[model samples]
Target: MKDGRHLVWILDDEWNSHELEKSMYNQHGFEVKVTRSDKLEDDMPLYAPCADGVVAQVGFQCRADVIDKLQSCKVISVSGAGYNHVDIEAATQKGIMVSNVPDYCAEEVSNHTLALILTVTRRLASYNRKVREGKWDPLDTMPIHRLSENTVGLLGFGRIARMVAAKLKPFGVRILVHDDFVTEETFNVHGVEPVSLNDLLQQSNILSLHVPLTTETNNLINYERLKMMPRGAFVINTCRGGVINEADLETAIKEGHISGAGLDVLEIEPPSPDHPLLKMDEVFITPHSSYLSEESIDELRTRTTQAVIDGVHGKHLPYALNQVKTETKI
Candidate 1:
């Protein structure tokens, strides 16, 4: 380490709680430097060459070009569960371990998913807008069904999806899950039914996505899959945006094939005002804020900093997403 301390660089655009992360890293004899993601390239030549580790958020893209520029970085720590923004293959090839704070926002995201389901199913947005605009007709939101009468399908039964299932169990809703990695026992223990992807898409009245973004999962919910869903089915995605084809979703909603959608993330963030989905009253969108809670943010920051500390100290990272040869010793 230079000057008896490890230097870690943080690339983020929205976070302002660096004091919390800085204090924790300082305790371990690490010096932290924070920079905005937009200015990372210019700042990299000045800071990255000497960085012992790097921390980044979803807004930052650490591709092969950026990865190739780091001269001494040993680990790339992501502040959230999804690390598709980081180039794992390039990091591994460069002997740089990549880690992520996966379990930090499980509760927050699952709660957000439930909120979206309730809003879309009850037509809460439509009712609220109509009531404010002097249209007080209960029939405006007709055909509202009880939660128990509908089936909810989960695309992937991971930590967050399991929490969603647990929260929804008391409502007596039939939950069907399709996850290749999970066994029938996993679903049985949660009081959920295990089903194939085709069955899940064909039978569910509400389909929620909770899978990571990968080659297999990218555009998993496409035109054909949307066609498989029963008419009037609602789609909710709190996971990565690329999992669902945005154009296909817009087409389905426009054609009245799919009833509505609740999306926390979109294929293109902060979509243009002219976007058709934004104009639809049947669609509800959040600005990728499903993983935010006071407690969760603190946990995410601490766990991410801890990963960098572990890497600098030559210790095993608890949430390492990639295996790399330990050649850079602090």
Candidate 2:
């Protein structure tokens, strides 16, 4: 392990995130390069030094086509909670250990979820819009609801979902979770009742989606699923945009099947100005900032560094995308 030439690359969009990453790697005696850009076509020039090990804040696709351009990329890490941005299967095939710093922002994101729920439920955005538009009497026409004694259905029972459950406990809300990965031991530990998807939709007063976006999970909450939900039920999506099916959600909201939505993500990041969801008074959005906060950033940086170290050392990594361990475990 002595005198190994270490290089870490950050392909992300945070303006000053590079400095923090550089400082961490510099202290550890590793050469670091941070290429920050929001526009892919314009920013390609900045990431010219992308070397052996790559750590990304939000994974940008690193296909074998571009991996062909990269001389040495031993490992790839997603800096945020989600890994869907990375072509995981592609990276795994290239023998690169793809990992994620998943748990660092669990509470922060769950908090954002609740914020969205409260904001939309209370018509915070609608009220703000009316106030800004100089309509003092719009409150009379606003549709608002109370959060007390409601049933909250979760799409997944991951760390973030569990955090949401814990936070909602004091609201006298019943927690109904659905995750094939969650076991009975977890149920006994948390006192959260496991329910099927259909049951969650049929009984929940507030349906919050927390599942990651994947091939099988894409459009998971389509038109049919939305119809199953109780009329006037609120939907909060702190999870992925693709899972809910943008078209289906827009229709559901338009049809008044769902009362409101608190969305932190969209079908496209930084959705176009003309996006219909942006104009909906019943919808509240936050530019995918659910996983962002000062406290979370500090933890994200530290966890990202450790994931890189673990990936390089050929040890187990948290949320590894590569099937190396699955293919060969001791």
Candidate 3:
């Protein structure tokens, strides 16, 4: 590294756009070393030369064991929405602030949820399947339901959920939301009725998951909860994959307990092609990418990377995780 240069080592290979990062950091005259490897030990070969501090994507493990390898490391940056993979408690104890990019794609996620909902509602997947099978008139088997009379239940009333509801207003669908963080007044603002999970399950014609994954949220929709949803209602999960039990979802869909489902994320990414759910006709699965547009990816990269850069320079984090003070500063 050049003398008087601050080094920021990168552990994410795909984002190793060396030129983009190099040009961006050169303004500040920092040495940017990128070591791209799935295994932390493999980075040992380049550790002394490349890694002064680490900025990682999903591939890099920031666990205590791997983090111990850094020599002059001062900060760790995680580039994605979730920070569960990183041991934030350990980092904080060591006086390193952990940060994440938040709400960069709230619009994109809400738009994607609606696309999934509309695909199932309009029977687009079924139509596409029929054409591939040389069957022209697929609509002969089933009719699309009218959205005007349907009840759309949102599992959480976060910013994205609110956008979904707003866009759904043109359809004249009834909106019900269940988020413990939401206020009754907030629901009244959007004409959304607040309800219990059971009530939401029983009444919704289409349901969407929007909450973050946490201890309280893991497997939130298990067998019993799946059984609770109205038999004909469609379930849409764009939230974290583990939020819904995979086995139970397959069972529920196979038994005709629920009408259909649209899943953007799954328990294990790139689920086996032969997974029972894939064989079924009622489920629409995308390979865990509802936030893949260039715009969103750029925002996530810049914001997440900048958060760590700011922390290293002794500035407050751009979007910190759970570090809100009474003054409400980020």
Candidate 4:
């Protein structure tokens, strides 16, 4: 280490580190380097060799090849919760700790999920558009069911999903949760009914995904599973875009099988302007911003940087996703 200062690299063009956060790192004797690169593979060879730690953002793939080339990197800290883009197995083999900031935006994401559910159930967007076009009619939003009579299903009962359940309780909706890892006590505590995956899909009037994107969860919601839901069922996703098969969802909406969808993410971010889902009146899309709030962003940045600092100092990371035997000395 030059002058006993650890070298940390920030690899994301889209997000700039807060000045205060940088200053804190500097105060801790860290030499922070910020690099903006659209292509991670092309840039890693040049920068990874010098970096003692790295804080990666979404859209930057940290695959096995990149992890293999990290010469001095003792830790890789992900800015957000999901770390599917990073090859944890390879990093573990190389004795590099991988950490993620998982709880920073739980409230923001849960709030966004509730917002999507309300928008779809109330048909607010469609009505607003029609009214602006001089076609206002109360009957335009017919078949609106009372929330109390409908069932809202959660695909994963993690922290965000629990928050969503708590918020939806006031709406008087029946909540059904499907998660393999959660126990019966968790369901009882939340006052949510636990069900199998297939049962949740078949029974929910609106299904919301809260699972991470992984090998098992990628495209977890495919055509067959989409068809399992009752006709006219609505779908909502605030989790990883790859969890659902976009092509199949489009087909279900087009064939009038599924009523609508409220998505905060897509299989591809900033999808082509002419994408089929963009043209559908029943579809509501956000720019993968379900986890965004001023407070949440600040928390995410602070926690991520702190994790990197902890790793460099040989302290155990609180949000470590994988255990690694690091060779870096304290």
TM-score of 4: 0.95
Off by over 4 Å in 3: 1-4, 13-18, 44-53, 70-72, 322-330
Query: Candidate 3, residues 1-330: lDDT per residue as tens digits?
Result: 325567787767556475755666767667776766655467565563334446767535667765655545556777876666677766655555567765878888888899999998887888898888999995564757888989999999988899999999998999989999999899999889999988998889899999888889999988888888877778899878889888898888778787788998887767887887888778888876777789998777777667656765767775666442222111
lDDT pick, better of 1 and 2: 1
For 1-330, candidate 4 gives per-residue lDDT tens digits of 434668887877667545866877988888877767655656666677777898878777777887787787888999899888788999898888999998999999999999999998888889999999999698977778888988999999999999999999999998999999999998999899999999999999899999998889999999999999988899999998899999999999888888999999988888999989899889988898988988998888889889999888789888898887657533
Between 2 and 4, whose lDDT is larger?
A: 4
> Tens digit of lDDT per residue, candidate 2, span 98-209?
8887788887898998888788777787777788898887556555556775788988998898888888888878889999998989976887889888998998878899
Candidate 3: deviation at residue 304, Å? 2.2
- State how far residue 124 of model 4 sits from its true place (Å): 1.0
Q: Which candidate gets the maximum lDDT versus the true structure?
A: 1
Candidate 1 lDDT, 61-114, residue by residue in tens: 888888887778898999899898899999899889999998999999999999
Q: After superposition, how far is residue 16 of candidate 4 from its true place, in Å?
A: 3.7
Error of 2 at 102 (Å): 0.4
Name the Cα RMSD for model 1. Answer: 1.3
Candidate 1 backbone clash number = 0
Best by TM-score: 1
Q: lDDT-based ranking, best first? A: 1, 4, 2, 3
Q: In candidate 3, residue 11 scores what lDDT?
A: 69
